[model samples]
Target: MVLGGSIAGLFAARVLADAYDEVQIVDRDTLIDVAGPRRSCPQGKHINGLLARGQQVMEEFYPGITNEIFADGVPTGDLCGNVRWYFNGVRIQQQEAGLTCVSASRPMLEKHIRRRTAALPNVVFVEQHDILGLATTPDKSKVTGARVQARGQKREKVIDADLVIDATGRGSRTPIWLQELGYGLVEEESKKVGLGYVTQHYRLKSDPYHGDLSINPVANATLPRGAIFTKTDGGRVELTAYGILGDHPPTDQQGFYDFVKTLAAPEIHEALMHAEPLDEPVAFRFPTTLRRHYEKLDRFPDGLLVVGDAVTCFNPVYAQGMTVSALSALTIRNHLHSGAAPQPMQYFQDLSKNVIDPPWEMTNTVDLSFPGVEGERPLQMRFAQKFLKLVQYAATKDKAIAAQYMRAAGLIDGPEKMQRPGFMLKVLLKGIFGPAKKTPAPPLVPIAGGHVETWSEYRNAA
Candidate 1:
């Protein structure tokens, strides 16, 4: 049994379908047939995209997912070649990292994965149910099932299972449930990131960047504003303006555009000027990033495990949440191949050390670079930032270094890949003697010959 119907939950259900006789999914919201956002998915309503590694896992779990999404009108491209990333106020060089990635509204993509998972004969979606807690053996040594209450019902029903997993995202109740079962408390690490964003959909009236699938200006300490503009289904675009350190993007129409005006790059703001608005600018707040150290617990219930954002929630701008969840799901598939009963402790340990730590450290390090966002910056981060700036500078002139850095950013390669002697020499020599081009923020100007569309001609016209 899986607790939640988010992408994490769906993936878990899909993988578990082969191992278990019947895979049941309990979700708080009603499932939908169409590809659109839902009331339960506040996170999906904003700007969201999958990283290269995420696309790999999703497609691996569901064969032909890439072609499936493309058929749905979601744009596909080379991970590094089609994306323009701005860090520390400078654009990263464009190069083909040879990684397949997709661009679509988060809601639309989730709907496709949900559709695939729901189609499995062994998988079933039990909608409009609240997960009360876990049902365990008398000694509380192992979880037997989950206690759930259907919406508008009084009595709780216990659905027995050989294994129970929680993919309920950042708001999961697993921690509380564990404590109630006499388990030692799991340590939680949280970074107070006062992040918020305003998002709206637009129809791309013009293509100025020459088929670039994505435009992004990341947040930095000097300038805490950022934005992402990308083509989704129906020849329409989604513009998400965001800020950290309590600099919330306003939701008013003009105020929303005003937020765009503050981004490090003018490309997104410029595109919005010529496009049409398909929806009102909506706002969402991400107050903090939380990571639960379930691996630290000495004793955990045998039949229970937590995965995805229920384990660690990253700042969405990095686009790590979905990908990290995918990694965890992959781990689940690997362990299940052993055909042993689920082992929560061993899974958590591997997940924490192999999957969660590196990305969590990288994200916190970048967030702390802002100075306004408070956190510890040990020597590793300090040293990494220096070398990274050098790499960023060198990447503008050297495609080799750019490709390596982009692959690392896409999670296809480890951080150690950038530290190779040959790569380091290239960056060092390029920084020493190269025709460096200065990439200042483009002056924000209106793109001519385009109109603002308040509504869409076709929702998924791809």
Candidate 2:
């Protein structure tokens, strides 16, 4: 039994279906044939990126899924070569790295995955059900099933299962339930980011990307603001403007336009000047990145396991959540291949060491780079930040370095790949001798009835 029906829960159910006789997914929202975001998933209304590695993993699970998405009019491209990536206001040299990128909205992507999972013969979705808690054995050493109550009903019932997986996301009740069952508090680690973003949809009067899939102006210490302007399905464009360290984008129309005009990439602001607004801007706040140290627990009930954001929630700017959840599903698959229930500690240890550690450290390091964000910056972290800045500068002058950097960013490889002796020497040489040249911002054209003016000038005139 799975306690949620989001992406993580669906992935868990897909894998568990191969081992168990029947896999049931329980959630408060109606799960079948829904085409839009659920009430429970607020992040769905914003831009959601599926990194190159995530695309690979999803394709592996559901063969031809990429083509299927394309069939639905979603754009596809080479991860490094096709997208415009700017770091610290300088563009990374574009190169063909052969990594596949699928540009689909969160709702569209989840809808496809949910449809596939629902078709499995052994998988069933128990929609509109509230997960009450875990049903544990009298000794509190084993989990027997889950307690759930249907929506708009007072009666609660227990559903028996040989195994139970928690994919209930960051609001998981496992900790409190465990404490109630005689286990101590689950250790937790958190880093305050105070991140916020506002999103709106638009219809372009003219193409800004030419043939590219998306334009990303990544946030950095100096600028501290950024935006992702991407082409999605249904002939519409999605713009998600963001800021870090308590600097948030506004949801009002003029305020949101002002925020975009301030981004490092002026082309995005220029494009938006003539585009048709399809919807009002919406905002989402993420105050911190959280990790529950379930692996560190000395005692946990058997027949129970947690996956996805239930284990860790990274800063969303890195776009690691869905990819990490897919990787966790693969880990679950390996543990279940032995045809016996997985051991709790061993599974968690493997998950922590292999799946969660790399991205957790990467996001933390990047988040700490901003001076305003509060976190420990030991000597090692400081040194890493400096080196990464150098690498970003070098990536502007060298395509090889840029491709390698993209590999690491896509989660296909680890940061250690950039530590190769040849790679490090090249980066140093490029930093010392080959500084990036300044590229002038594109010229802005006047709209139908007005002369082009600076965003500040327009604001003052108003």
Candidate that scores best on lDDT: 2
Off by over 4 Å in 1: 32-34, 432-435, 439-462
In model 2, the worst 10-residue window by lDDT is: 450-459
Clashing pairs in 1: 234-462, 276-452, 276-453, 277-453
Scored against the true structure, residue 47 in model 1 reaches a CA lDDT of 74
Query: How big is the positional error of residue 108 in model 1, measured in Å on the Cα after superposition?
Result: 1.3
Q: How high is each candidate's TM-score?
A: 0.93, 0.95
- Model 2: residue 358 alpha-carbon error in angstroms: 0.4
Q: What lDDT tens digits, residue by residue, belong to model 2 across residues 1-462?
A: 999998989888988998999999999999799888889999999998888888988998888888888777786777789888899889888898978887788999999999989889999889999999988888989999999999999999999999999999999999999999999899999988989999998876655675566899999998889998987877678899999988999999999999999997889988898888988999999999999999999888999999999999999999999999999998999998789999988889999999999999988889999998887899999988888888889998999988999999999988889989999999998865544985865454444333212222222332
Which 10 consecutive residues of model 1 have the lowest summed lDDT?
453-462
The TM-score obtained by model 1 is 0.93
Assess each prediction's global lDDT (C-alpha) against the native.
0.81, 0.87
lDDT of 1 by residue, 130-237 (tens): 999899999999899999999999999999989998998888888898889888887999988899998888765655355466788778777888888776766577
**lDDT (C-alpha) at residue 397 in model 1:** 78
